[model samples]
Target: MFWTGPLVTALILQFISLGGGQNNDPDVLLESSFPPAEPSLMNLNAICLHGSGRARYPASFFPPSGYAYARRAGKAVNRLEAWFSQCCYEEGAKGHGQILCCAKQAWEAALSHFCTEEFSTMTMAHECCQQRGEDRWNCFAKQAPNPSYQSLPGYLAPEVPPDRIVFTWDPYTC
Candidate 1:
């Protein structure tokens, strides 16, 4: 309980900085006066995820809102997804095994994603989960630790809603 205040403050500061699209309302004035992107879908997803995660997971332990943590996690997930997508695109571009470069990129991106500060230990814990590959996310899910699995009031599970909305993150430890 003592730790909750600081964490909530941190989250709130992050939430405001990210400019949560006004309940996702497009008409809201920009709090930070930063311009929005036009064609970058990834950027848009990143923004939305940051806001959504903050809105949904404003627990006492984790910062209530933060672009720093949210953006970091979001980018890691995005990079991992992009790498996997690139592998498919490469498969289409040439033929299976022809795009070794893309395959390498995918593997490396997956590794980098796993190595992020938030997920490194968890990735190490989940020996079977690769940064990419068919069962990667599933494997990571299996490695989630104790409190995360407790089904407590504010705990977030590795299983995010919208099953299609997969993440490359370990469950929040705190």
Candidate 2:
């Protein structure tokens, strides 16, 4: 009987710890304690740095939220940003329209590939967003499968001469 008492107490303690001890209600535990951070130009610039003669787009071109709704979303966004920074440098005023179009297409493609299928609903995204600080972003980042980037045909054709091709962007899709 004495041994049973200790075992039961230990089990109860374990359960309480797992449940966060202070609150057993899951809803309460997941509730957002603060409002979401507003997206800033500085934050966007930090992610998409301008250098190496690459064409630089304004912060408005990037997503407003820092938290990626899916695993692939994070990678795709990062890749798109990097591509713009590296490949679009020589483009000048006349190329701004093309650059904007490409950025929009890439953003749409990334969001469509992952966000549309699973994290489409605001409720699902909210679940991760409610998590505090970096935990929230980390939680969302893990929600989808990571996709590998592949160069599209004609863009980086091995048969084509090296001097002829100046730049390439990998194709990403669902």
Candidate 3:
């Protein structure tokens, strides 16, 4: 778990390292707001969830000033992750390492969803949208929906033990 603690801290730092900081709320920072869904589950519930779970603090949240909003939002996410790490660590209890691992797994999973090649391409679209109108582009500049506790592939998916995979909670006892 100690490994996980440093690993998460490092990841968060790395995320922040990629961009400059802009004052914003970090707690509300979310990688993606889209919930995971099965291809077969295209039902009303899924649609409803999809509509309701759109990204928070989307680029639309900013004024139609310029790309400053996107830059600022990115920075805010970094700051949020940093703050989340500090606060969660403080409240991580006796098994702080385990908690770190959980958070790390969650973060990695979240990153995986948004930082993919497809997502990278979206950057171009976002930029183009910005050119069209910062206000309009803001609508497109949103983080993907967050991965749920049960939907994190790295954590929730079955895998071999003893390897560097996510740890699950044992229900029988603490």
Candidate 4:
């Protein structure tokens, strides 16, 4: 279990590297490599779950701007994976600023994935209708598909070791 984190991260980085130097920009190459699904499931936040079944952060806190970005640029799959890896890592870290920085980068990268016109249209299509801002975003993320386990032909899913995948959010947080 202890070794799974590095292993999974290595596997994903390896997979991403296999594309060669087709495009210098990792973001562009990633977008082109994995096209968006119809209606798009990329807007979901990838939260890390501890063994005790507690979430590292409030599940509904972050924005789905990442998903919106991926969809518009036609790179939903890879972008989603990036967010998942980052958030999952944050779960094991202790610094608040670092975690927030990662989350911010995740959102910004997704937002800047493509042109403005594309971003606006895609975002509007998926805008949270009933729930207010954060609530709506949370619902979207919660309902969004988990890309970590998303079935893709010819692609191996990450092996989440039981113990490593589960842990108390903070053993000392009374």
Candidate 5:
């Protein structure tokens, strides 16, 4: 069920060692916000789940601001997977327009929250975090890895166990 605590915090720290996990609302749950979807159905290896999914980045961008941003950016894919189950498959919004819009929204919100957290600790936030609206999305879009969702050689997605890392989710400023 993925309780929201030790699982994520430990995953983040553990993933780095090996290696990691979010949310807000004391009584509300981000997990409950969307339907559950298996990671297999999610093309978890990809940075973006739509289009050619083509986007790459350079190093020094905070784990180069790409998939490895946080536990190979697992949470980003986690949210997208849930949205896909809820919006694309469950709701049957499979058209290009529907899926594209869903992916963009999912991508934006996931990255925005990532940036919000990233902004909190950095003396200078990542360049992508400095952007707002489409700019930020575009910047993140440019760094999408495995955009095609094709499996990376020798790379396997990790099994999500239990507990989730809790984030403050407080608004952060650069």
Candidate 6:
């Protein structure tokens, strides 16, 4: 078992200062993880597939409270990235609005999944989960480690499975 001692702390901190390492394959998971630093969500600069651009801190980046949360969070990121990749390659003709819509759906779905997991545990759901609509997004926006996803100097993303989410083009949904 990996201990969250100074060594691990220092390692994660190093990742923050000098960019994080790849998350490995989606099917294969790391042994253990520590939550992201409290103040800044810059712990890892998550790269979306197909050049869709960097995303806010993904659930896979910091994850929820425990190891059990890792698989779910990682899957959520995989789906998000997959949808982003589709948006990048397939939705180009549809305009950014459609791309953004896909993103929003994936994001909210991830959060809804997170809230479900939270309640599954002994702990109460995160405060932001209690809100809905723009309020939910606004609450999450405030908790971002940093406002923008800056490049991690020389970090690169690994190849993950192109998991897909069901998305239909409905302008009203956006």
Cα lDDT of all candidates, in order?
A: 0.33, 0.32, 0.32, 0.35, 0.39, 0.45
Tens-digit lDDT track of model 3 for 1-174: 111233443443443333221333333222332222211222223222232222223343343454443434443333223323332444342444444444444433333323332244524433323333343323332322332211212221111112122223322232
TM-score of 4: 0.30
Model 5 misplacement above 4 A: 1-72, 153-156, 161-174
Q: State how far residue 40 of model 2 sits from its true place (Å).
A: 14
Model 6, span 22-105: residue lDDT tens: 343322232222111111223222323323332222434442344445555555445555555555466552655565565556
TM-score of 6: 0.53
* Sort order, lDDT high to low: 6, 5, 4, 1, 2, 3
> Which ranges of candidate 3 are over 4 A from the true structure?
1-61, 65-94, 116-174
As a TM-score, model 1 comes out at 0.27
Clash pairs for candidate 1? 11-64, 11-65
Tens-place lDDT digits, model 4, residues 50-154: 212111111121233343443343333334334545544745544544444454444334433433335356345334334554564454444433223333233
Highest TM-score, which number?
6
Clashing pairs in 2: 54-89, 55-89
Better by lDDT, candidate 2 or 1: 1
What is the C-alpha local distance difference test score of candidate 1?
0.33
Q: How displaced is residue 76 in candidate 6, in Å? A: 3.5
The deviation in Å at residue 17 for candidate 3 is 22
Clashing pairs in 6: 40-145, 41-145
lDDT of 5 by residue, 1-174 (tens): 332444433443333333111221211222221111222324433423431221111122123233333432345445454444344445544555554455555555556666766676635665777988778666655554333344223323343332143222111220
TM-score of each: 0.27, 0.28, 0.26, 0.30, 0.46, 0.53
RMSD to the hidden true structure, all candidates? 15.9, 19.4, 17.5, 14.0, 14.1, 8.9
